[model samples]
Structures are given as C-alpha cells and as structure tokens.
Target: MTGGVRDKDRDAARDDTLRRFLLPIGAVIGLAIVVFGTAFLYDKNGAENLLAGIYQLLGNNAGATALRNGGGDQFVAKLVLAAMALLVGVGGVWLLYTGVSAVVGLLSLRKQQRIIPWVFVLPAITLLGIYLVYPTIATIYQSFTHGNNGAALANPLANYATLGTQDFPHVILNNVIWLVVATSGSVGLGLLIAGLVDRVKREALAKTFIFLPLAISLVGASVIWQFVYAYRPPGAPQYGLFNAIYTAAGGQPLDWVHTQPINTYLLIVIMVWLQTGFSMVILSAAIKGVSTEVVEAARLDGANERQLFFRVIVPMIKGSIITVATTVAIAVLKIFDIVYVMTGGRSGTDVIANRMYDEVFQFNQPGIGAALAVILLIAVLPVMYINLRNLRHQGVGA
Candidate 1:
C-alpha cells in the first residue's frame, strides 16, 4: 500500500509539470493559425498592389518596373504573407505563454501564494523585443555591412570619411562650440534672470516676457532666423531684417549661410534663447527651496549680498543646479532640431547626428550610420549616467 501511494504521488508531480509547459505552447500555436487565416482572408490587395500605385507615383525611380503589375504584386504579397505568418505565429506563442502564466497565478492565489505583476507583463516584453531590441540588432548588423552589401549603393564609409577628414573634424568642433556657447549661455543667462526675478513684485510679468521664446518650436526659430538672414538684389527693396538694417547703414547685405563659424554660432543663439527659460524655471524653483533662515543668518554674520548668495545660497541649491545643468547638457547632446531646421548640416554646421542622417538616407550607407549611432550612444551614456545618479542622490530614488 505504501509503495503504491509513493508511485501515484510521483506520477501526479509529472502531470503537473507537463500541464504547466504544454498548455501555453499549445495556446500560442493555435492563436497563430487563427491570426494567419484571418489576415489572408482580409488582406486581398496586399503590399504588392499598394507598392504598384506608389511606384507609378514615384515616377522613373522604380528599379523593377518589369516586375510591377501582377508579377511584382505577387512577389510582394508573398513577402507580406511571410511576415504576417511570422508575427501571428510569435504572437500566438506569447498568448499561450501568458494564458498559462495567468492560470498558474490564479491557482497560486487560491492557495494563498504570491505572484509578481512582472510575470503578467508578457505582452509588453514581447513588444519591447520587437520594436526596440530587434531594430537595434538590425541596425548594428546593417551598419557592419558595406552599404546594403555594396550592390548599386553609395559608398558605405562616405559619411565617416567626410566626418573624419580635416573639413569634417571642424564640424565636430563646431558642435562643441555650439555646446559650450549655447548650453552655458542659456544656463548662465537663465541663472542671472532667475536671480533678478527672485523676489520682485512683478516677477511673473518679467518671467513671462523672458520665457516667450520657449513657446516657439525649433523650426519656427529657424524660420525667424531665415528671415533675418534674407537678402535681395542690390537694387531691390530689402525684405530681410538684417538686410534692411545693412542698407540703412550704407553697408552691403551679407549671405549668412556662406559665413562659416559665425553663422553656426548665430544658429546656436536661437537654441539658447529657447532653452534659457526652461533652465530659469527649474533653477528658480531650486532657489526658492533654499532656507530663508540661512540667508538671514549670513546677513547677520556681516556677509554682503553677493557673499551670501555665492557662499550660502549656492551650496544649498547645488543639487538643483546640477539637475538643471545635466538636463540642458542632455538636450544639447541630442540637438538635431536646430541644426536640421536651420542649416540642414550645411555651411560648417554639420554635427554627428546630421552626419549620421546624411550617411543613412542620402548616401544609403546604413552600416556607417549605425556605427556613428553607436558612437553617439557611447558619448551621451556617461553624461546621462552621472545625471541620473545625481538626481537619485537628491532623493529622487531608484
């Protein structure tokens, strides 16, 4: 009787393990079949048919015009079908896994057991794998290849070559100039503005005026600058603000874009103007958080206004100051908007991101673009890591 009972218990344990594994797998496979059948039934005029219309609209650039109409549509349809099959198949698998996990969690709950919500987040995990991880891997892979395997594509290392050359090295330096001039100027000017408006009666009104530029988008700022740089024929009336001023002063109008280094700095000014308000607001809050009692004590100790501000107020608010600086620094590092909108990485203003864009899109060198992207990622990671660490140290927490 004892031997029989032990054998039965062992069999029961095996059954439980089998059930845990098989149900989820079966569920996913079933879901995939259903999804695939449904998609085939619904998508009659699939990717091929869509691409045929797009090709005609695109004019003569279609490489496989002979393969268009029925033939091209057929090929594209097969590709789409394959993709749909894959997604549906994986989704089904995940669905099954989720169902199984859910059942297990429910059973455990009945027995007064614990289940983490992280386990139930299978769907999010699947999406992250698809959208984030897959793209990053693909990008790295393509970046290793020499321009889509070097068949009828632009030079793979063209962008990097351009970037590495003396001329292109200047672009990196130009970006550095932008970072130093724009980020520091914005923050410093913002700090000054915050100090000025710290305790004024009409501080709100003053702040509103200073912060007005923050409302403008990078494109809008560029357009405004464009108008300022606008020129006309010598005999014609000047529509550009700067040109009009030049004519008024008996001087010739300048082509701003043609001017190196200076034009780049001018573009940086627009970013500084827009970003200063953001810096000011954060720093202003930090300033407000400084203890009033400390300021009073400093004054009592015969410290002058400037001494009290520098010696006492600054040290107390260092955390907030660092937060604002790091925020601006990150913004500076990722700044493609101003560069893209204003000059399109032209006239000695091309930065790493713009260079990457030129490589990937214009030159069709996806591999080099990926490499540059990785380089950029490496550059920003340190700054971001420190910033996050400081933020958490300030009691923001993990």
Candidate 2:
C-alpha cells in the first residue's frame, strides 16, 4: 500500500508539470487566433461578404434593404473595425504579456528572475528604436543629401550653409528671443503667482484660474488669441479685444499679429500664458515641500519678508526653479503651433520648427528641413541634459 501511494504521488507531479507548460502554449495559440481573426475581419473583401451574409440572414425585408443601401452596413463595419483595434491594442497586449511571462516562469528560479525584467522592457525598447532612433538617423542622413531624389550632395554641408542666409538668420534669432522671453516670463510669473497664492484663502481656486490656459491646446490658444489680436482696416470698427481697448483709450487700432518683431513678442505672450500655470503648480509644490522649521529659523534670525523669500525660500527651491525654466525653455525651442496658427510664420515670426515644416511639406525642400531639424535637436539636447542632471541630483529616478 505504501509503494502504491508513492507511485500515485509521482504520477500527480508529472501531470502538474505538463499542465504548467501546456497552459502558456494554449494561451499563445489562442491569442494568435484572435489576432489573425481580427485582421481577416478588417479586410475589405471579408467585411463586405460578412455584411452581405448578415443581411441575407435577416431576410429580404424592406428595412434590411434600406439599411444596406443607406450606408448602415458601412457604419457597422467602422464600428467593428474600431472594436477590433481596441481589442488588439488592450486585450492583445495583455494576452501576449501574460503568455510570455508564464513561459518565462517555466525556467529555473534564478534564470526567471534574471530574464523577467527584460521580457517586460524589451517591447518598449523595440518601439523606441523603431519610432525614434530610426527617424533621427534617417533625418541626419537626409540632411546630407541633395534634392528630392536624395542624391549625395557634392558638399554635404550645403543644406546647413543655407541657414546663414535668406531669412534663416532672422528665424534663428526669433527662436532665441522666444527661448529667453517666453522662458523668463513663464517661470517668473509662475514663481510669483505660486508664492502669492500659497498664502491665499482659496489657493486652489486661484491656481485653477491661472492654470486653465495650460489645459488648452497650443493651437486652440492661438485660435482664441487670434480674435484677441484680430484687426480690420484702420477705418473699420475694431473687433479684436486689443484693438477695441486701444480705440477706446484714444490710441490707434494696431494689428498685433502682423506688426513684425513686436508680433513675435505677442506670440510669445500666448506661450507664457499657457505655460505659467504649469510652472506655478510645480513651483508651488516645491515651496510647500520647504521645511516650516527652516522658514521659522530664518524669520527668527532677523530676516525680513523679502529676504526670507529671496534668500531662504528661493535658494531652497532652486532645483525646482531650474527644472521649470529648462522645461519651458525646451517647449519654446520647439514652438510651432502658435506661430503657425496665428501668423503662419509670416512677418518675421518664423521659428525653427515652423520653418522646418514649411521647408519639408510646403516648399518641398526636405534637405533644408532636415538640416533645420538637426539644428533644433542640437539646441534642445543641452537643455534636456541639464534638466535630467538636476533631476538626478534631486534623487529622482534614482
């Protein structure tokens, strides 16, 4: 009887091991079926046939005929496609990860521990390589080539050479102006608002109102501001808010967006308005994180209010300030939507990104566009590096 019991226990262990291996295999096969099935259903020929079969099953009725003829079948097909996309996006990823992880579990304990992290991380790395790294390398290559055919240029630097002439210098200058003015305006106002609102009775309410514009898309903010800066001929009634206010105050109606050099500054105002809220929220949290004891110590040591703020508070949150400034500086470096929507980069308002877009898409000058893109990338990298270094010093992502 003891011998029989031992044999039965051995059999049970074998069966359990088999089940563990089979389960993951089954899951992978099931997921493959769903993926392929969805692809087939999404195909046009398969979709048409499926719709026809469904209509036939519903019987040859007037309602069925009308529905098929009225594009209801197409609408249904769209819904089916959308559903399949969602399933493949969410469900497919979950299923794949589950299967992959289960398979990894079948290995030795030490091996499993070593490999599981890569199993989870490999997909993200693959995606970044495909989407980001490939495009960057390709852009660099294209920047060295000539013309639409992508032939090797006799002088590889010719595209970059063009940047020194013909409005490009002004464009670069505008970007620099935006980087300085927009970054300073946003960070300065954000720091001020954050400091003031920290003492307010309804702090949340004040922050909400100031931060509201940040929620608006850059394009949407530009559209809203277009009306604010809108202009008609001098004799026509001023519809723009600025013009209306100016006319009321006995000043001449001025076109805010088209008034060169100044118009660029006006565009920068929209960025500052949108970004100040972000800066304010971040700086506010940093201020709150300052130790109350340290603040009290400074006050006790005969530090006045202004000195306490500038010397004590600002120094303590200097990391946060640097982070916000660098972050806003990067945004200003790549600014495009506001300039595009408001002035279409007209009248000396063009920045690097807008000019890149024009060269690549509108003007069919891909080489020049690629060169501009490389320059923009070069300009942004240092700011990003500084921000990352600061974050590291603060023990972020440690």
Query: Best by lDDT, which number?
Result: 2
The Cα local distance difference test for each model comes to 0.73, 0.87
Each model's TM-score? Answer: 0.65, 0.85
All-Cα superposition RMSD per candidate: 10.6, 4.4
Q: Which stretches of candidate 2 lie over 4 Å from their true place?
A: 1-22, 37-75, 107-115, 384-398
Candidate 2 residue 380 C-alpha distance from true site, Å: 2.4
- Give the count of colliding residue pairs in each prediction: 2, 0
**Pairs in clash, predicted candidate 1:** 28-92, 143-367
Q: Per-residue lDDT tens digits of candidate 2, residues 6-108?
A: 9999999988787597768866875795678677666755544455566778774554555555445667756666676676777777777888888888889
| lDDT of prediction 1 | 0.73
In candidate 1, what are the lDDT values of residues 1-398, reduced to their tens digit? 99999999999989777667766566556666656546653766545544565566778435336435456446665676677666566665567555656456436554424444555576689899999889877775655455543443366555456457655577667767877788889988888788879979988898888788889988888888888878787878889888899889998877776577578877888888899999898888888888888888999999997887778877888887777777787777667887888778877888777877877788775666676776666767787688688798998855
Best by TM-score: 2
Kindly report which residue stretches of model 1 are placed more than 4 angstroms away from their true locations once superposed.
1-116, 137-142, 148-163, 233-235, 246-250, 302-304, 387-398
